[model samples]
Target: MKLSYMASLAALFIALPAAAQPSTRPMGPGPMPVFADFDGNGDGRITEQEFIDARSKRIAERASEGRAMRGLSQALDFKEIDTHGDGGLSREEFDANQMRHFQNRPMPPAR
Candidate 1:
């Protein structure tokens, strides 16, 4: 009975998706900055605070007529994006992150 249960568990594990594995496969070159001017510190990294400040400033600029985002929402969003836990992101980290976003994005019809 114990062996049968173990076999069922093994089969369940084998049926799981492969998405969790980290690939060593190279990602071609990587996306160049869509907006480099935002890196004001010039430290080859974008700190969490800098990212939040820059995003807020840009949103405020475009929203000259009125506010669009709440303070809490912005803070939470920044926290979510700052995944490295280093308080800042190296350029490679940022680029690879952007690539992850693209990879997860839904594909369009091939037409």
Candidate 2:
């Protein structure tokens, strides 16, 4: 009985470190930003016009902050992101675009 207890304790010690190690894989994209933040009229959906207006606002804010605006000037290709073929985008479609964009983007080199 004493030998068995010692073996069990040894096994637990060996497993603990492995379990405690942080995961290396990237985590899934979390919930999208509040819809009202983008959905201008509180209509619960985002139209292409609203999206463009919001993007323009964001670019202007970045420019005011003296941040680089190189990529912000271009318009968002709403058709490419509107996966459901609807005239407007639901919150899910917006979030999916965010995830796809992040996954496909090239990572910056480590310092």
Candidate 3:
């Protein structure tokens, strides 16, 4: 009886972790994946090299799709958004620039 009880407890411990594991699936199509992909070093911050590489990859993808690749033109202007001139952007700085860009963009006509 004691052996059976020990086995059941062991099984419960193993199953709990498997059940608690976070889903590998994305919650939805979103920019979080883009940010994570660009963070090549797993350092939670993007260096200029990582940024450029990611941009190049994205441009290629867009070209393959026969899209105009309009966004790439401004994405590499790192100096403008670097703010502190540090030559690298933390996630905060990157997101700040995105917010600024979104805020300044002209609204489309109310259709």
Candidate 4:
């Protein structure tokens, strides 16, 4: 009886974690995965090299999805985004640029 009880307890313990996990993430677009690894050094700032590397990754991902991007335009260059002239892009600057870029893009009419 004790052995059976122990086995049952162990099974329940193993099952609890899987059962407690949420089935799926909430619907709709959440944060982009690109930014998660953008700051490679974890210094809370992105150097030009970091930006270029991350941008390349993003471009590759978009290409694979059949949505190839020609890359950043001359107007919105890295130095342009680095408003502080500190040679590093802060979180605020990155977010603002992303927001502006998305907002200006003309949307395709729905089917």
Candidate 5:
């Protein structure tokens, strides 16, 4: 019984290192930023200025991490996403725009 318990513990220890290691495989394109990401002031709306600032911040973060910022280089601006022409974006408009843009992009084949 002592030998069996020791073997079990040894197996667990061996497996732990592997389990703790993060996956090296690419996680594919990152999630599209939503209105919340652009709503820097948490005001539940994204003005054009807020959109540009937030996008720049996001780009800087991804660049610093050496991450490929795919699907983010869309030609979209705040006016494009502000479907209602209200001069600001609502969550619904943002989500709809994401669906139209991000969801339609063809993913690259897995290596």
Candidate 6:
């Protein structure tokens, strides 16, 4: 009787965790990945000129739509968006960042 009770208690203890297990809530996808566009310098690193040029083009394009982006805001988001931590965003990073920004936004309630 003693062994049976002890075994039952142990089984109950083991099963409790499984019963109380947290729901598998999705964290959504992680930040986007980027690559170095290391221009054909053969040095295997992107140049400052390339970086500035890209920034300028983006500003021009987005600005035309009255979507002027703040440099400080972009930098803050850039630091977080560049998953590789290399301080520069590749095409992949830019696309994913845009995608997630749109997808993750809260939708307006139905009228």
Model number with the top lDDT = 5
Worst 10 residues of 3 by lDDT: 25-34
Pairs with steric clashes in candidate 4: none
Q: Rate the local accuracy (lDDT) of all candidates.
A: 0.57, 0.68, 0.66, 0.70, 0.81, 0.54
At residue 96, candidate 3 shows an lDDT of 84
Candidate 1's residue-wise lDDT over 1-111, tens digit each? 999999999987886656567544422322323335456677777777777677677666546544333332323354455677767777766666566656564433243
Worst 10 residues of 5 by lDDT: 23-32
Give candidate 3 regions above 4 Å deviation: 1-34, 103-111
lDDT (Cα, tens digit) per residue for candidate 3, span 46-86: 78888778767866765655544333445537678778788
How does model 1 fare in lDDT? 0.57
Compute the lDDT for candidate 6: 0.54
Best by TM-score: 5
Arrange candidates by TM-score, descending: 5, 4, 2, 3, 1, 6
Better structure of 1 and 4 per TM-score = 4
lDDT of 2 at 85: 87
Higher-scoring candidate on TM-score, 5 or 6:
5
Better of 2 and 6 by TM-score: 2
lDDT of 4 by residue, 4-76 (tens): 9999999999999999996443222223444446787888998999888887786676655555243235237
At residue 88, give the lDDT of candidate 4. Answer: 94
lDDT of 5 at 55: 81
- Per-model TM against the reference: 0.42, 0.56, 0.54, 0.60, 0.67, 0.31
- Please identify which of the two predictions, 4 or 6, would achieve the higher TM-score against the true structure: 4
